[model samples]
Target: MTADGGPDGAEPETNTGVLLFLPYRALENRVFAALAEAGFDDFTPAQARVLQRIGPHGTRLTDLAEQAQVTKQTAGFLVDQLEKAGYVRRVPDPTDRRARLVCGAEKAWAAKEVADGVVAQVEKEWAEHLGKRRMRQLREALTSLREITDPWA
Candidate 1:
């Protein structure tokens, strides 16, 4: 073992970016599983990423693309697929006559309910593992990090 008690020659586990991604990916897997169990097997991971970024009322295509870290064309393509799947619909933006807003539909709401339940279950598991105090601290730390890490937030 090295001086830090890690394996000899092993790299230090200081990559907070990667550390953050692990839980995110795990949560995503659970969400996907929940969606599949709900018979919403038509959705793709990419589409889900886009869908998650959409605001409750509606969101612009450009904003979705920005938040999803995808090109506008890619966002539009995913939106089209979501539209066809009956999970989302594009309505004319009231503020901008030329622009459209993507809004969640009935199917999306149903899937969201399932996803929310899964998230709550996973969070409860995490809380049990970390204990309530540590879990709260973890959330607070992550929320503080968001000030620096999240552009949209």
Candidate 2:
């Protein structure tokens, strides 16, 4: 669809940015669907948030909880489920054996690698339509919006 054409041929600028945001939500849905089709559908969005925080370096459950904005108990419960699903594991922290580090399992790691490629391909396709400069500007605007909306950090 042409950006200038609204839902029914009217100009979208007459309204707010709802038209722009609707397409963005649709894009997110498509990306999520792609990941699910690739076998990463077992986790909830909250679980995905937790897993994203763990990453390659790994992170403490408490830290993940803080970053995910969930209580420690809630984070622990999510981690437990993820562990049982073979997406994550808790290993002893070398610096502090008393604490455990949350890490991605083999399946989760592979999914992340695949998802990275999928996202890059999606962005490249979008860049061809929106231009690289607009895409970069969109990224900056989204980052700023997140910071503004999420007061807790």
> Highest lDDT, which number?
1
- lDDT of each residue in 1-153, candidate 2, tens digit only: 545685577655534466567766766676678789987888887777788778587889988898888999999999999999899989999999789999889988887887777777877888888999998998898788888777655
What's model 2's TM-score? 0.73
The TM-score between candidate 1 and the true structure equals 0.91
Give the RMSD in angstroms, all C-alphas superposed, for model 1.
3.3
lDDT of 1 by residue, 38-123 (tens): 89999899999999878899999999999999999999999999999999999999999989999999889889999999999999
In terms of lDDT, the poorest run of 10 residues in model 2 is: 11-20
lDDT of each: 0.91, 0.82
* lDDT score for residue 145 of model 1: 86
Candidate 1, residue 65: CA error in Å?
0.4
Candidate 1 yields a Cα-based lDDT of 0.91
Cα-based lDDT at residue 30, candidate 1: 91
C-alpha lDDT (0 to 100) for residue 84 of candidate 1: 95
Name the lDDT value of residue 62 in candidate 2. Answer: 89
Candidate 2: regions farther than 4 A off: 1-24, 140-153
